[model samples]
Target: YAGTGAQRVPLPTYAFQHEWFWLAPGVRPADATASGLGRVDHPVLTAVARIGDRDEWLLTGRLSIDAQPWTRDHIVFGMVLVPGAALVEMALTAGREAGCPVLDELVIESPLLLDEDATVQVQVTVGAAGEDGRREVAVFTRPERVDDDEPGEATCHGRGWLAPEGEPVTAPPGQWPPAGAEPIDVDELYRRVNKHAHLTDAGFDYGPAFRAVRSAWQVGDDVCTELELPDVAGSAQGFGVHPALLDSALHGGLGMLYRPGSEGGLPFSWSGVRLERTGSTRLRVRVGLADETALRLEISGEDGTPLARVARMDVRPVEQAQLEAARRSGRRSLHQIDWVDVPAGTPTSARVAVLGELSVPGDRYADLAGLEQAVADGAAVPEVVVTAVETAAEAGDPAERARATALSALTLVQRWLDSESLGEARLMVVTRNAVAVRDEAPELAQAPVWGLVHSAQTEHPGRFTLIDYDGGGVPDWGALLDLEEPQVAVREGRLLAPRLGRAVVGEPPTVDTGGAVLVTGGTGGLGALFARHLVERHGVKRLVLVSRRGPAAAGVGELVADLEARGAEVRVAACDVADRHRLTALFESLEGPLSGVVHAA
Candidate 1:
């Protein structure tokens, strides 16, 4: 049972983005009579379990059974978090309902991943008020700090149906109370209470910012509403407003008067908030503020139907002092952030090559540009790489096919530049293909070529022409054939056949063409060999090599310069993927319309 007059804040915002965490039978206690309500011998799987404080966010978790626990009356639990992760806190509790004692409390922290919007929820079991006289059979959510330095009350704002043990209250469509009701004139009351209320450090007020579009309220401790979302809102999903919207609803619902005299400030926190479904759809939000700070918030579909959801803090006023103290000290941020880096053994990056016919391949290029910009703006790194798929399905002569493909590739590169806000960068071409140029509208064996990368009107073949630009020069090869020096490695799943030492890089002045290849991880052994092949047999107009480490391997810079002197285009770039800030800046500095990317990085 939640204590009487426990302040509660509603959490209508958590529904759209919460992750699901169904407790396994083994994790739950079989009996409340056991010590500490059936001790959880198992350490929580931090990655799978939501962890954090109501006010702070989620950080990292380590084995620390000895860590201090947050306590209030009979309820008790510990906290876990670390730096560079998220700022969140988690808690646990035990209590009773009716005459049957029961395990009661659980809490979740907030803003777990900074700038990555989250939706969360919490659940609690309650019984009849004890001789102490609180509420009978209730659930609490959205606990807030009432005093700037004290645990605030959890408020009730949404729909509520009584537990099996208690009498249920229902409000039909139009008979419920006004939405987000304004508190009774409590300024003077707040001042009077302030004079006697003991103050403690709970945490900062999350401060509200989500804009509300529509809201409704019911008398029985719940509030429901719909809101308009913000732009550029960052979510785990590539593009959306779900997470951001829910957070705003939770924090915004905490618009309660602070009791300057009270010892406890806000009342509760949440365990998990999730967005089960999202889109340009109306959201159903429910909140039940038990008091000024303690609350139970639930969001659903447009017509009071259940949907994806989250619960909030099950906090009470009596425990505010310690929570407040933890909040004031900077140590509070330790609850939700995880610090390990993604391991590199697996392929960490991939580039997709779309090989098909299209008009204005520039449009396709633009799509890639937008994606790049999103990454630069703090989105998680993309798991898949993308590039123009080389194809031979166009309806045109040899020269026309080559021109269309290059132009399409150029369009994509330019789009990337636009997304990054780089001014008018042009495509550079390089090739060392030995085949004589074919004549389409004119004798073009030595003429410069240009056009759309994928034009619908062009006739093309339907084969994947694998080209090997081994470090050794194979002057006998032609450009029309998908030529490679027969070097082997993995390509599109299967192993590429090995054709070693096909073209030597140092003696370049050989083949000539009009395009370039951007080779990331260019300092690696395979990268060097590819560079040599491009310079020798492929007649690559340019070879740009990017690496995490500078030009330290194999005198690579000197070799590229020598190749350049022989009429090939060679450039070098140094970068690291882990350095997110630096990588963003680097992307903004790149030229556009690249023929292709060898994403070895």
Candidate 2:
């Protein structure tokens, strides 16, 4: 049953799950299987995400395709994570013998929540070459396949817990607080552990649950906690703790609050979530019981704090009829928006059935256009639509083929589906300038429209046209820039990007490598002293020394290492960037992309 207006706002949703993907470090012909089953010319790799209770999850990946359709061909994908530094390197390697086009430079792109703890570093190197233009792109740390027939071998690696007087227990393989788990100093043990970082990693902290059990007081039906997080850098702004982290924290805490029996935990939704980043030292999170089946949580740090008052969830079985009814309703609801899956730069239009009344100040489009006009009248310039494909077919023209194309180009789609609970929706793109010879040319008008609105509307009122055809939605709307100034979008708006100007083409891409490689402490200190010497003598390209008081810490160490490995000779000294003499020396080192430098005190 639905609630009344008083309880109208449904709780937001989130996911908490563990996922795995196989990682083959290298794929060499010599190492290929002996079986004639087509040498592992190019092995295929797949990643699987496992939902907490459900058996399936969403997947994220990149791999090489094979000629033969049958045998499971997988490529080795891997990534390295830096513990002390916020950096992760993803690599995807192809077979030297794989009959694929040799690439000059492979672009590795991964999206990350702005404030997430882990930062990504990408390395693209030209692997072995063969007759065919085969090139290998390495994506570090390939995800583990959750469904692999082979079970994951557990290994213990963490500090062991030592009793003040009694014998210390070494964590066994597959045990929490592993045998070598970094033991917390006695002084630090009394301080609350920072599980937020772990929980935030990959949106969940399944690993810690194994350890949280160590501090269990009494397991109950649910667990809750109020935590304070440091707002050291004040980066949090306008976002809440990722839902995955919140869910995982709840999962772990509940495991502690309610042990032994695991039940009555069904995620309903989140409500009253308020996130703020105050200029405080630590982030403070408060969780309280809202009711029988709800928990209120508020998070805040020096930068941003959580404002969610409650997390409502349900745990129940679905009746077959109810499930069937839901399926039917879902299909009908989804019918509103026509989905078209196209390459990142496919040009398509959509017909949006504007719901509600269109009054004098009516039409959301008009409002959007008006807003654009206001901006244009001021400082903002009018934006043009960028098309991804050649001129769309003129309506009714025999050449205009409105058939749906497969989404085989995008591997990310399958990856997300394999690891998440969400499913891809199908939609159509309608071309506004389509010339239909017949009055009844398969009414392209669909319930919900998806298309781009050209800023030209400000100059050419009523000239807005929708580009729609049968296919799938373009994974990246940026492809529209490849076409004529034609706006494309869905009537319901795009989930990835909404404003047209936001995706303007022709902007040069620049990676902020945190300026220079940074080390901790001043140049005179440990990291800086090493950096200074390397810069003065080494063939270093650039040197960044960081010091706590001198320079605000910048550039993760893992990133510096990767840049060096990939040919961007870099050195980092943990010293202060504020020191003029030190900073000048680091910057003055004459050179085009420094060759090599050192980072030590």
Candidate 3:
């Protein structure tokens, strides 16, 4: 049968795509076609998306110490940073998606700490294949400052290239514990390694599951070590290699390179890693110099059966300050609302009922109540419902009226619950003249509605969409149907999405809250508290406490008098910032110049 004519075309060069398929059963990755995200099977990565029409792709997921307690144990300088082995695993996982599973090279740039209570978000990006057919991929974590809907600047933890599957590893003829390999005494091994942990941040700072190296032997120029995965997660059941065990494999050989006189020694780079076989817990590892720059590893099952091999791994000394600074960056990370641009897709073609006629053409309804009654009377329900928020400027001078506006929106939320016809409908709360763009004076009076609507959205997710316009052209009303960004801003015909970022603050030559300092929401819970602090702490003699309620708000008179008695000049202005003209007049009436402002409202 073999003699029959058979033409042999080139067999696929990449026999091992290195794709990881062992995942937790029944748990599907997050993928919504409507949002333009595709499915990703990696355990850590939940969603994947190709950027526009390009070949670049982004994969994202979230991890926390609370969920993956193993990460909680890897501490360096008292920082709970994820181990480099886990990051390489992530690189391998992402590389497979880009069609090149062979990890040609990887560099861990920064430490990503996992907060005990908060989740750290991660993103892996794969770029288009280069001329040599290698694709560059990078792993970045959003530190602790992460927003589910709005991703901010991510700190790159690692970056590398995934090449087409290279030559397969060929293990030499060997038996378990090869003859002539001198056994090294390891009685004081872990104790000696951890002895200087308190004095030097470079000590083997690992906890229970991470301490996996069981014994060691010197085989001529190479070191062979035995390791067993700890009892907590005893088997490499669903992983290419148990991450803790994989990490310990690297640790097994570090003693050969890390000298006491060295200032730093931590894994910096890895290359040509291939998972020859999938499941293994007990491992026999051989570590030797592949070249002058790095160490090579041949990992095998306890019986000397090959499991994985690395062409090279380099452990370069990294400064304590660099790692410390990375931790500090996580601690100092802050977030502010940043509007990002988005596409203006077609609005929903389904019937839409507009409550008030400020903007957006839809079926007319006198009010939310009218719409509710029409639905109650068996009228055809709209697929969408919308309303324009009225700012305090439009309502009156009292910014406290903003709370009343929120109450009105609440009525609609409650009426929707009672309407069976509009059960599947969505409510779009659009504000034409409100937003807290950094360093800009927005309609503060209309801000409370945003908070109230946000709470309702939390309680009943997917029922409400918050939209704001920077007071200009009619927004591409289709924005409401865009589930991609439920909360967005419309300005100059472009849609903007809100993202959180670290708040950049600079110091001037002098620090002063001198002269007249204004505090909005100055009568409510925090307003009164802030006024007292300004008077007591900052030694502010002149103070203006402004709230939407102003003088009419209960306890405002008492608060003003109390601050005045505290050796301070207090003026409780009954002016709303939303009332641009009234606010200007109040400033003009001031005895001195306004020095500082706090928009607590």
Best by lDDT: 3
Superposed by TM-score, candidate 3 places the C-alpha of residue 126 at a distance from the truth, in angstroms, of 1.3
lDDT of 3: 0.73
Lowest-lDDT window of 10 residues in candidate 1?
Answer: 68-77
What CA root-mean-square deviation does each model show from the true structure? 27.1, 24.7, 23.2
Q: Any runs in candidate 1 off by more than 4 Å, and if so which?
A: 1-105, 108-224, 236-247, 251-253, 256-282, 291-293, 308-313, 316-601
lDDT of 2 by residue, 422-512 (tens): 1221111233323222232433322112212232234434334345332333323434433333334332223222221322213222223
Candidate with more favorable, higher TM-score: 1 or 2? 1
User: 2 or 3: which has the higher TM-score?
Assistant: 3
Evaluate model 1: give its TM-score. Answer: 0.24
- TM per candidate comes to 0.24, 0.19, 0.49
Ranking by lDDT: 3, 1, 2
lDDT of 1 by residue, 1-601 (tens): 3768777788776674544244322222344334323222222212111223221111112222121110111111122221100112112111111232211222333211111111112233333344543322222233222236444233221211111222112222441234445433323322322343332133232212223334443334444455444322222222122433544444323433234443443334443333333342445555555456554455555654444334444444534434333333322221332222111123222322222222211223344545456556765443222232342346367677656655555555445345433222222121222112222232232122222221211322221122212123332221212222112122222223332232221232333355567777777777777777776677677777878775766678677777778787777777875688976776676675456566676
Model 1 accuracy (lDDT, Cα): 0.36
> Which candidate, 1 or 3, has the higher TM-score?
3
